[model samples]
Target: MSKAITNNQSVDLISDFKEITKMRLAVSVVFSSVAGYFLGAEVIDFVELLLLAVGGYMMVGASNAFNQVIEKDLDVLMDRTKNRPIPSGRMSVKKALFIAFTFTILGLLVLYIINPVTAMFGAISIFLYVSIYTPLKTKTPLSVFVGAFPGAIPFMLGWVAATNDFSIESGTLFMIQFFWQFPHFWALGWWLYNDYKRGGFFMLPTGKRDRGTAIQIILYTIWTIAVSLIPVFGVTGRLYLTPVSGILILILGLGMLYYAYKLYKNRDEISAKKLMFASVSYITLLQIIYVLDKYIRIWI
Candidate 1:
């Protein structure tokens, strides 16, 4: 009976590790970093690429872990977040806190091996995400803007990791993603407004599902699409979008805008959900298109 109890405890410990680190989310962020690296690196080093992947995962995982730890109290208030390991009592706050520290330190150390600048940015991302974004969520809706800073950094961080410097090129990547976040997050806020309200999180800029919030979403969606096309017009260096790819991207962007408009016009739960789904598809597909364009240029 004692042996059975001990084995169960061991399994539970392992499960808690996965929950705190959010391994699945870490993997997704790592994939985006690698994709950005491949798009930016002039000379690909498999070893460096592997390091970037692992270090990026650690940094993102640490941020997510700390976020859960800090939001443990509020997590219990939202239906969407209520079942998370911390709030569900499956993981103790102490254990989650310890895991957060371990992941953050290990993640920063790994990135430091890549380059100090890359590591510095990684630390900044985690800091802003947890230290600023988490608490600000309840205070103001501008938390989304603050969150976008760190969220956009991952894509540009890969370029800095490869080049060991920040340049207009990296800045352009950051701008494109930075603008993309507003519409994406606002759409999510619209769909989850009730859940967020229950948790005392004001995610929408206007703090209501009104014309103001919808207008902001549409405006940002336009800006996101415009920034993405800047390369095609020769505004940014060494970045060119083929006419074909640019057209396809524009179509996708317009689709996103249409959904945003729908939300504004209808102001219903169903419309908001559609916009949320469209925003996700737009981001993932945009990254893919950018990567494919890079490879196609090599072949051409």
Candidate 2:
């Protein structure tokens, strides 16, 4: 009986840890960084790639843990976040803080070993997410804007990790992801506006689910599509989109814009949800296209 009880306790601990770190979201962040690393690397080093993945996950996890700690009180008021480890009392603040600190130090150290520039960007991402963005969520709608800085860094950080340089190539990658976030997050804000209000968060740009918010989503969707096509122009070094991939990217962008337009026209949760899913598909497909195009260009 005691052995069985111990096993159950171990399972509970693991589950709590996953909840605290938001493992799925961390993995997605690592995927973007890995895609950037692949684009930047002239010769792939598997070991460095492994380190990048681990460090990226650690940094993202730490940021999430810190956000939970800081927002525990507010989190309890929101249905979506009320069950998180901290807010639900599944974990203590001191334990969560310890995990956050450990992950932060280890993550930065690992990235530093890869390259100083990568480590510096990783540190900045954590600072911006935890210190600036987390607190600003309740203060102003601009929190999404501030959050985008760190949110967009992973894609570019991978490039810096591989090249140890910040050039037009990395800048273009950053800009692409940066604009993508506006529509992606606004769609989410639209869908979760009521829940957010319950938690005292002003995440939407207009502070309400209105025409102003939908118009902004459409405008940013346009900007996201426009910036995504820039690589095909041959300006961003080491990142190029061939004609085939360019056309496909345009189609993907249009798909997202179509959904955004639907949301604008309908101004309903269903439309917002569709736009949210469309935004996710747009970014995933766009990145895959970029990476495939890079390799194809190299082989030919």
Candidate 3:
């Protein structure tokens, strides 16, 4: 009976790890990181790509694990989060902490093996996300600014990993993702106001889905579009935007903005959810365009 109980406990541990790490979210974040790597890399190395996927996934997993550890108490307050492993009593605090540290160390080691700069940035991202942004989320809305730093790093992290150094190109990659987050997150805040409020997470600048917040979202949406088109003006180095590509990008940006404005004008839950979905579509489509544009020019 004791041996059978031990076996059952082992299976439960594995299950709890998956739940605590938010495996789905972790996988999506790593997918974005891999997509960035493909866009930035001149040569698609299978081994390097594997390393990137592993390191990126573990880094994100570590951040999320630490986040859950810190917010265990608050997680129980939110309806959407209360079923999480930590808050639901499926995972112990000590076990979660151990997993977080293990992933953090292994992720840094994997990135370092790939390239030192990659490891450095990976470490920095983990530090910022776990130490600063996660704790600040409940304290102030400025946490969004803090959170964006780590959130945007994956775009440039891939560049540095591929090139083994930072460059203006990497900065440009960072800028694109950095500007994209404000409008994306604000839309989520608009739609999930009650859910976020329950946990004391101040996700919006105004803390209310009002005209002021909506206006900021629209302004940032415009900036996201403009920055995306900068390559067309011949200012973004090897990242050229042909007239056709530029036009397409502009259309997509405007589509995103159209919904942002609609949400602002309507200030309704339905509109907010629409804008939130649009924001997800915007990022995914923009990345696809970047990759497709590169391939199209190569084949032409």
Candidate 4:
């Protein structure tokens, strides 16, 4: 009976931890970093790869936990976030802070073992996400821009982790993801505009779902596609995209643009949701194509 009670307590704790840290989002961030590592690595190192994954997860998790701690009150005002650990009373601020600090220290130490540059970027990402972006959310719509900086870091950090040097290749990766976030996040903001308003978050460029927001989304989508094709110009050093992959990327980008255009025309929730999904598909497919193209060129 006592063992059963202890097991239940353990399960509840695990659930609370996952909620506070946003495990799924953390895993996706780690995935982007790993994709960058593959692009930058001359030779794959499984041990270092494992460390990157774990450390990346922990660092992102720490940032998310801290964000929750700071936004606990605001979170309660939104349906989507109200049940999160801190806002829902599943976890206390003190406990959440402990988790955040533990993850931050451990993550940075592990990244430092990989390389100092990697650790440096990890720290910067956490600081920017928690300090600048989180607080700016309620103040101005430009918070998305600030958030994009940290949001874009994982891709470049992966490259730096593998190479221990910052180069044009890493910069290109960073720029691609950086621009990608605008359309992706704005579409999300469009769909969640009401919820965001309830939480006092000014996430959209126009502060409302209007033509201006949709037009900006389309503009950023175009920019994202253009930057994604930069490697085809053969100036990104070790990062090269074959013509076949480039065409596929263009097609994927067009797909996203089409949806963004539709959202502009309709200016409705359904259209925004479609744009959101397309944005996700575009980034995921683009990253996969990049990794696959790299290996394909190696074999050829």
Whole-model alpha-carbon lDDT for candidate 3: 0.86
Question: Could you estimate the TM-score for every candidate?
Answer: 0.94, 0.98, 0.93, 0.98
* Model 2 residue pairs with clashes: none
Candidate 4, residues 1-300, lDDT tens digits: the string is 999999999999999999888998898899999999999999999999999999999999999999999999999999999999888888899999999999999999999999999999999999999999999999999999999999999999999999999999999999999999999999999998899989999999999899999999999999999999999989999989999999999999999999999999999999999999999889888999999999988999
Tell me the number of clashing residue pairs for each predicted model.
0, 0, 0, 0
Which structure among the candidates has the greatest lDDT? 4
Residue lDDT tens for model 3, 1-300 = 999999999998887888777788677667667766776788988899889889988899899999999999999998988988899998889988998999999999999988999999999999999999998999999999899899888877877777787877778778888888999888888888998999999999988888999999999999989888887777766666678888988999999999999988899888888988887787777777877887788889
Off by over 4 Å in 3: 1-15
Candidate 2, run of 10 with poorest lDDT: 234-243
Worst 10 residues of 1 by lDDT: 231-240
Can you rank all candidates by lDDT, best first? 4, 2, 1, 3
Q: What shift in Å separates residue 246 of candidate 2 from its native position after superposition?
A: 0.7
Give per-residue CA lDDT, model 1, range 63-173, as digits (tens).
Answer: 888899888899999998898889999988787777778878888888888789889989999999999998999999999999999989877888888888888777888
Tens-digit lDDT track for model 2 on 1-300? 999999999998999899889999899899899999999999999999999999999999999999999999999999999999888988999999999999999999999999999999999999999999999999999999999999999989989999999999999999999999999999998998899999999989999899999999999999999999998988887788887898999999999999999999999999999999999889888888889898987899
Candidate 2 wrong stretches, greater than 4 Å: none
Note the residue pairs that clash in candidate 1: none
Flag the better candidate by lDDT, 1 or 3. 1
Ranking by TM-score, best first?
2, 4, 1, 3
**Candidate 1, backbone clash total:** 0
